[model samples]
Target: MFRLAHISDPHLGPLPEATAWQLANKRIFGYVNWRRNRKGVLTTDILDNLITDMQEHAPDHLAVTGDLVNLALPAEIANARRWLTSLGAPEDVSVIPGNHDAYVPNARMKAEEAWRPFMSGDIVHSGSLNFPYLRVRGKIAIIGVNSARATLPLMATGYFRKAQARALSKLLDDCKEEGLFRVVLIHHPPLKHSTHWHKRLIGASRFRKTLRKHGAELVLHGHTHLLTKAATEGPHGPIPVICVPSASQGLGSRSKPPARYNLFEIGGKDGNWQCRLIERGYSTEDKVISELGNQMLSVPNA
Candidate 1:
């Protein structure tokens, strides 16, 4: 069995001091918001403990959906690189970007430079880093797509362009032919109405259409900071789309759940793949991490 661990939206804390010029644009909003609302909630200690517990499980691979930094400051981006190294080697962990990682124009470029190793594909077609990259791990095909982009102030939107859609379609078909379990990773929830209009993923309809045309075994994302289970249409049937709570969120939040992560045990063969989902994280009643839920997502046909 291949054990894959999923985590997202760490929003790594202790926001570094930023210059006036750095905070002059959309990052100003994120800076203020982090100080007033998120500073106390998303703590490093919480994330550290959670990571410790997750490492104990020793998953075959780790998928970080996005939002590794808070303000996308240069220092924050660098710190995130160190944190990713601590998590594991680039070969063992795959990452995609989130809206917060691209809080300002060209900030995503900085993040990409720092995080290229963790998000890079096995083979580069154009000799440059591009989204919708494919990485094969055992029988699994991990496809990383970039949905996060810098938006106007007060907006936290993501975009899924037609270019990526076309690339993703081809990747899905190729992986299917190879009899690999395709796991598509994006930062934003792709289903319609999954998030607020100001934060929704543009071109979601086209994205869904591509998925319906060329199905994947599973889709993982993290932007809502809520534990969500939803499905979209696929050629074979319904495809499972899952979102885990922020990896840095603390308890006592009125709206959002505490930090959590998921473990998926993928087994079986081409015609009868079996998957088991195990949810683990903190709760309102305790600080210790424990198993919250375990159930079969896909079962072998009789």
Candidate 2:
């Protein structure tokens, strides 16, 4: 049995000090919203809760869906790396970049430098290429892609380069032949919705079609900062799409749920494959313990 922990949008930092850029955003009220609607109850309280919860669960691999830092600032990225290192080594974890991480023009370079201490794989250096990167773990292969790209001030959107999209198709095509469990990690959802078109996954349709053609077991992403569930038609069946809640919002209050994480278990079940989502969160009442619940994913054989 393989247990993978999914957590997103931690936005770790030295607080308002490390992320001055985010502080200057016109949407400053968004942070206020986090304080009121999310885990903004105490100082260092949320991070404390997350660490305790993750340690207790001890998942086989930790997959962070991005937004590790609030502003993609050098200091914020450094702080993000520290938090991630505290969680576990890069070998035990896989991370993708989120829009926030790419907010700076040199976001990619900054991230690579800041996270070098924890990365388990070699950085891809092809000109104009930044994704379809692979992280092989046992029989499961994690395809980490950079969906966060620098955009104009008016845009505030994210996009995958055309080259990256094509590379992704080829990557999946090759992985399909290996019969490995393919898990694509991105910060943006492939399906368009409330997010601006410019901000949405630009090549989502082609991306999904490629997944259907090559076959993938799961797609994990986080950027919406809300809990979401969707299934895309795949060659094998409908693939599960899971969007996890944020790790730190502002305050833990009654109006909103406290910070949370997702725990996924993929393994053999009665000669068939099984994958389940375990919603895990910190219990305010318990304070020291992490709460959990199991929910299975149903993927039909095509």
Candidate 3:
């Protein structure tokens, strides 16, 4: 069985000291948000403990959906790189950026430089990184799409442009021909109602149409910071769209739920695959990572 672990929206905190110039644009708003709300809820120690617990299960590979940093400050970007390296080698882990990574106009470029290893795909494109990239591990083909892009203040929308959506359709078709368990990874859910209007993924209809046309075994996403499970119609059956909460959430006097991650045990042949999803989250009461629930995820043709 391929043990795949999924986590998202760490939003690693402490908000590394920002220069006045750095906080000049959208970052000023982000800084305030971090200081007022996110700072108390998320912490580096919480994230560290969560990673240690996640590695305890010995997952074959890890998929981080996005939001590795907040404010997109230079120090924050640098620290996020270190965190990613400590998590695992590039080949053993896959990542996609979040809106926070592109908080500012040119922050995305800096993030790309720092996170190239984790985001690089097998087939390289010229100039800059392209979406719909593939990484074949065993019989599973991990497909990552970049929806993270710079947006106006107070907006965290993701983009799936016409070009990327078309390329993704082709990639999904190719993976189907090869009989691989395709898992689509993105920072934002593909469905329209998955998030608020200001934080929705643009061109969601096009994305769903591609999947409904081609078909995939599973779809993993983040960005809403909620533990959610929904489905979209595929050619064969309903595609499992799973989302996890922030990985660094701390439970306080009246705080939110603790950090969580999903472990998927995938096996069986291409058309006859089986996946067992285990939702595990940190228990503040016990100070341990315990299983919240376990169920058999619906395979394409189970």
Candidate 4:
């Protein structure tokens, strides 16, 4: 079975010294938020320990669904780069940014340049990176869509626009022809009425329409900071949508969930697939990432 691991919203912390210029814009709010709240709950050591423990399982591919840095500070971004390197090589890891990564205008561009290799498509058809990037490893096809973009203050929403939606639909159709297990990775959960309006995915209906038109074996996201299982319609049937909690959050915070990751075990032929999903996470009591849940996903009828 090919194993895929999913993690999100590291929010790597301890604000790096930022110039007044950097904090003059939207970052000022984020910087204040970090100082007043995040710095206390998001312990660097917790994230470090979680990664070390996750590597022990050795998933075939890793998907990081954004929020790698806090306030998009230069030093924070640099630290996240080193952290990604510590996890695995760029090819072995696939990433999509979160709202926090694009906390301010043009900040997403800086992150893209800094993390080009990790978030890039496997094959550059246009000789430049674009979403939805397709990466095929073994029998699995991993598709990444960038949903991170700057929004007005207190708004943390995502959009899978018409152009990207059309492209994603086509890519899913092509992957179906290849008979690979298709997995779409995004940062926002895309769940209707499940999140605060300010934090919802703006183009979720369109995105869901694309899934219904083209179909996929699975959809995974991580913005909710909760271990959640939801489904939306696909041509074949209902497709599984999985979301995990912040990978580095500690136990003291009541607002944030504990650190965790999801493991997807997939194997089988075109007509029938056997898939098992296991949730592994860390707890303050144990301080280790252990199995929290195991589920056998319904196999699609061919």
Candidate 5:
């Protein structure tokens, strides 16, 4: 079996000191929000404990679904790279950016530069990093999709471009032909009405249409900071779209759940693939990381 661990929205913090110039634009709002609210709930200690426990389980690969830093400042981007290294080697981890990673116009480029290693695919696109990149591991084919982009203040929406949709459709078809279990990683939930209007994934309908037309084994996402389960139409059946709470959210969070991560044990072959989803994280009663639940994801011939 190929074991894959999924985590998201760590929002690594302590708010690296930002100069006045750094906070001149969209980051200023994020800075204020982090200071007033996010600072208390999203703690590094919680994230550290969760990662320690996740590493103990020893997944074959780690899939982080973005929002690694709070403000996407230069220092935060660099610090996130260090954190990624601590989790595992770049080859063992696959990451895609989130809305926060592109909080400002130029921050996305900076994040892409710092996180290139973890976000790159085995096949290069003309020596440039592109979305819908393919990374095959054992029987699993991991596809990284970038739905993140800079938006106006108070807007945390993501966009799924037509170009990415076209590329992803082809990748899904190709991977399906190879009989590989395809797992798509995106930062936003693709289902319509999955999130608030201001924070929705633009072009989610197109994204779902692509999946329905081409099909995939699984879809993993983040950005809600809530443990959620939803699905979209697939060729064989409903594609499992799963999301976990923020990796750094501490207990007693007023608005969101505490830190959590998912482990998916995927096995079997083309006509009879089997996948089991294991949810693990902290509970309100204690800080310990433990298994919360386990169940089989709907596969072609489960």
Candidate 6:
């Protein structure tokens, strides 16, 4: 039982040319703030009903915790690399880089040139510290952090770069603490007690003192598009800070209403290690948005 999927901030847009000052930041005016309020701004029919409700919930591993695009628009990151290649075959899928995809402090090489065609062969350019990258698979250890840089105009701040917190403390001490389920994908929100102060994450208390000195049990994130709950006392303990919302919303406005995705299921029981949260259900009759039970557990994890 190793399934996990948690989408976030799919701000793909109807780009025509908005010189990427975060599309003229009226709090990130994506698609001109959904034409002044709310209407699913860049609708490929709501990203084809969230890629047909995530290929009918076939989540073995998919975590896109970032604003795919709204204005770091090299054509909205090439339509967010065709919405992450229609949600599949990018080695299942795993992405990171929020804060409007680094609005041009060299835009992290323009988000690897519009996400290198849906992360061609899982782009892990570990220039050692630039944007914190590490991706293991077997027992699962994904640590992709690059809280998208380039700030100041209206200042939506974020930064986790104490050499990516010591390269996430040597990739969580070389992941194999007997069980191996150290998933730490970050797109900002490394603790602000639920962010604010002009949108926090600037060193967030040195990233919560390096997640209490490397004991990440799972610290997934997505910039406060919403659905946020926080925690942080982790030396292999209480550290569940999962946030998910904005799978496709220029401004259909949901501080925490719908647009969901957070399914996980880790294993290794008796020896002590478990996880939950698989709730994915959304239907719209003929308009169709179905996803029912991939081993249901609608939220049970302190």
- Predictions in order: lDDT: 0.92, 0.70, 0.88, 0.86, 0.92, 0.66
| lDDT, model 3, position 183 | 96
Superposed by TM-score, candidate 6 places the C-alpha of residue 125 at a distance from the truth, in angstroms, of 24
Q: How many clashes in candidate 2?
A: 9
Give the per-residue lDDT of model 3 (tens digit) for 99-165. 9998888888899889988888887666677777899999999999988999999999999889988
Q: For residues 1-302, could you state the per-residue lDDT of candidate 5 as single tens digits?
A: 99999999999988889999998898889999999989878998999999999999999999999999988888999999999999999999999999999999978888988889999899765555799889999989999999999999999999998999999999999999999999999999999888999999999999999998899989999999989987889877899999999999999976788899999999999989999999999988889899998999886532
| Total clashes in model 4, counting residue pairs 3 or more apart in sequence or in different chains | 0
**Residue ranges of candidate 3 with Cα displaced over 4 Å:** 253-256, 284-286
Ordering by TM-score: 5, 1, 3, 4, 2, 6
Lowest summed lDDT over 10 consecutive residues: which window, candidate 5?
123-132
RMSD of each: 1.5, 3.9, 1.5, 1.5, 1.1, 16.0
Candidate 1 lands at a TM-score of 0.97
Please write out the lDDT profile of model 6 over residues 1-302, one tens digit for every residue: 88888888776766545654645544354354546744444355665676577667677879887777655757667667776877877677878778877765656467766664333323445432345666666677777777777776656678776787887787777774534777788887877567777668888788788878767677888877666656787664567777876665433333444465778888763235677765453332233344434443222122
Better of 2 and 4 by lDDT: 4
Output the better candidate (1/3) by TM-score: 1
- Please write out the lDDT profile of model 2 over residues 48-152, one tens digit for every residue: 677677778789888888878655666677778777888887788888888777765777678866775443344555344346678776667788877786665
Positional deviation of 5 in candidate 4, in angstroms? 0.6
Poorest 10 consecutive residues by lDDT, candidate 4: 120-129
**TM-score of each predicted structure versus truth:** 0.97, 0.83, 0.96, 0.96, 0.98, 0.34
Compared with the true structure, the alpha-carbon lDDT of candidate 3 equals 0.88
Candidate 2 lDDT (Cα, whole model)?
0.70
